[model samples]
Target: MNLAEKIDKILANEVPFLEVAIYYLDFTVYFANLLFPLFLFLSVIWFTSKLANNTEIIAFLSSGVSYYRFLRPYMIGATIVCIGAFFLGMYLAPIASQGFNDFTYKHLKKGKKAYENTNVYRQLNENQYLYVGYFNVTEKTGTNFTLEEFDGPKMVNKISANRIQFNEADSTYTLFKYKERRVGEFGDELISEAKRDTIFDFDLDDLTPVKYIAETLNLNELNDFIAREKEKGSSYISRYEVVRYKRWSLPVSAYILTIIAVAVSSVKRRGGMGVNLAIGIAIGMVFIFFDKIFGTLAEQSDFSPFIATWAPNMVFAVLAIYLLRNAKR
Candidate 1:
């Protein structure tokens, strides 16, 4: 479906050739994280079923090989895949995620309003804080903007503007209907201006923050972001936490899915490879369904993000163990 959509865009000349190439590359990287485990599972089922049908597994058993011994090679292969997936999840996927989103908003969603978080609050530094009631990234403008400068627990200056526009060429901000207040030990002084142009310590990226900004950050950066969000009492911290925990959970799932696939297809059946593939697909769908449900629950409700990220893996791990035991017997 995704490829078809991109091809349609190409045929219609809706996106540039270079952008289409980058989009395909980014989508491949992003989907690899989701599809690799499923592909591995299906491959394991198919290969093992072939061996079973050929009596290779029975031959090995008759040669006094223990079931666990027979499983060593499969486990080793799963470990290699797990490591690769870990690397992708921790490093490459974040870069690809950012590229994918950038391309999407710039080309596919041209002239459409991107849903940016309204009423953003951020600590620019130890002594400065910023706020914006609403910001439009495409327009490079914000409404009801404010900047407060503090001096060791006391706000020394405050600047508020009805609207602020960012000048990309000059790297400055133009404030309309702006007000400034300076607090002194004795009293406060206020100044009003119909229009003002000044340099802000921040930039356009500060004004337009992405909701899934967490997804674009590597693990170390994500941890730092989540810590800062926690300090600020951010309500969306759960969403970031979900992305962080899923990085670990997804790689670990490769091992679980590998074992489940082997156990399910190691015995030759009357229906053969088709039956094994059908079973594998069904299991894969169930795992995805559970993952989506728990992830959505965590984002929408008060459910623990750690639990939500790991619940799918835990459930499948138990299933793997059960199947392994049966297969061994």
Candidate 2:
């Protein structure tokens, strides 16, 4: 087939069917990806135009046999940018997006879910702490919880309760259906059948800043949270650790995207730079959409975060390298 035929075939394949949401989504992301490169390419053109307008190009061409030689450095720079964006978008972007989106959707959005608002653990001191089974933000109540005092890694006292309610008005916690036991230097004793409102002097630190859960964290915060959670025997720490690693991998995408842009738009053709930019945008969008889709796959299943994040970079890096070599020749 001719070049036109091949190009047509590729575009046809890229254009998604009207009936498929995934296809439309892919198109949306692909188009979005194209915008960055188009801007970059235009900026290149703008600079080139400035040089040409100011007679700089003429000066260079007057001195040298070919003006194209001056473009070599720009091409090399673009290549470096491409590689940087590719790594950033392909790996680092996905990871950052995962954490960033979760933090945004979970906390920033209105109408917080009950489950999201529930459960809080706090540290009162080196050896004293509290736990709430559930904290209902709407009702300002927590149910089925415990308060414990540890003396040098040994439990000295345990307080168990069927329900604890936080009085938001006074910033205090009240225990209901409670039992308290002490086994310290004074020896074992029990206090039972407690009913009170605002009985605890403890500040609402146990439940304040209600959005302190694991999902609200970025990569570094997630790492710190995981370590703290591990010390407390939190089973969810492993999951957060996986997410933390993924976050660090996201910034590499900017490099990956830069490569794809440069590789595709660097060509000089009779059809003009516009066509090349359009093509670059179309291809970039597809890759971006794929990145997000792969991310969702990782979230929904046991997909390797590294593979899911880096696959687009790998594929596009190969493609960019091929295109760059072809353009150079």
Candidate 3:
């Protein structure tokens, strides 16, 4: 289905054939990294179920290999998987995600654009603040733009404009109906102009209010971005924090999910491997559902990102413990 869709898109958009391979490779890496732990969960279930069905596990146990001793190899394997997942999410996945999103937005989005955040506010420095009522990304323009510089508690200079547009060529801005009120030592000075072009200290690219940007940034970039947003009082800070914490939490879930899978599928039953696979699928779906529900809650509300990211694993760890005890018997 995806191949057919990509073919249609390539023909419709006149996308170069060279880009097809690049897009697929980046997308594959991004998607595989994103679901690596989930894949491990299901694979462990399948392999353990097969072993149980063959009674190989029973023979090993009968030969005096303790259940905990049997788990040593699985634990080592899980640690390797966990490290690989961590490395991918920290470094490789971010680059792949950026490429995939860039390709999609450029070729596949087909006139769709990210909606500009409204009521945008930023503190440029300890004493300077900026505001834009609305920004248009396609046009690189904004309405009701204001910049104010404060001296202690009182505002010293207030600059307002009816409209503002950024010039990418020279890294400057053009402001229409510009007015500046300056509080001088002598008295108040007011300057008004039909148009003005000036440069600000801040970068508009850094201030861009685009969604899903956190996912495309590497660990260092994400950390810096979150800190910058926090300093600027960005409303989407919670969303970025959730992404940050999940990078760590998701890799750690490899251990939790592995333990659960082994305990659930290592026992022989009348129905054989089929019954164990059914149970594994159900558990995997529940784990995914909980992660999504809580992660969305953290992004959309005031919920703690730490708890949102880790709660699902914590809940399933108890289930792993219970199942492990039963499997021992």
- Score candidate 2 by TM-score against the native: 0.51
Candidate 2 ranges beyond 4 A from true positions = 1-109, 118-133, 146-160, 167-172, 180-191, 194-223, 233-250, 269-274, 297-308
lDDT of 3: 0.88
Candidate 3 lDDT score at position 244:
93
Every candidate's lDDT: 0.88, 0.57, 0.88
> What is the C-alpha lDDT profile of model 1 across 248-326, one tens digit per residue?
9988898999999999999888998899999999999999999999999999899999999999999999999999999
TM-score of structure candidate 3: 0.94
Better of 2 and 3 by lDDT: 3
Query: By the TM-score metric, which is better: model 1 or model 3?
Result: 3
For model 1, give the 10-residue run with minimal summed lDDT.
108-117
Per-residue lDDT over 58-132 for candidate 3, one digit per residue giving the tens place of the 0 to 100 score: 999999989999898889999999888898998889889888988888888867765444678887777888889
Model 3, residue 217: distance off in Å is: 1.9
In candidate 1, residue 238 scores what lDDT?
Answer: 80
Residue-by-residue lDDT tens digits, candidate 2, 1-329: 22243345435445333423333343344333334444555466545545544556557656854534765667677667666555544444444444444433433343655243356676655687777777766677778788898989888888888887877667766789888898857688988977755466455544543332543454456667667656654434434544554443433444445555545554444555556556765776777687678766775676776677677767877776777566444
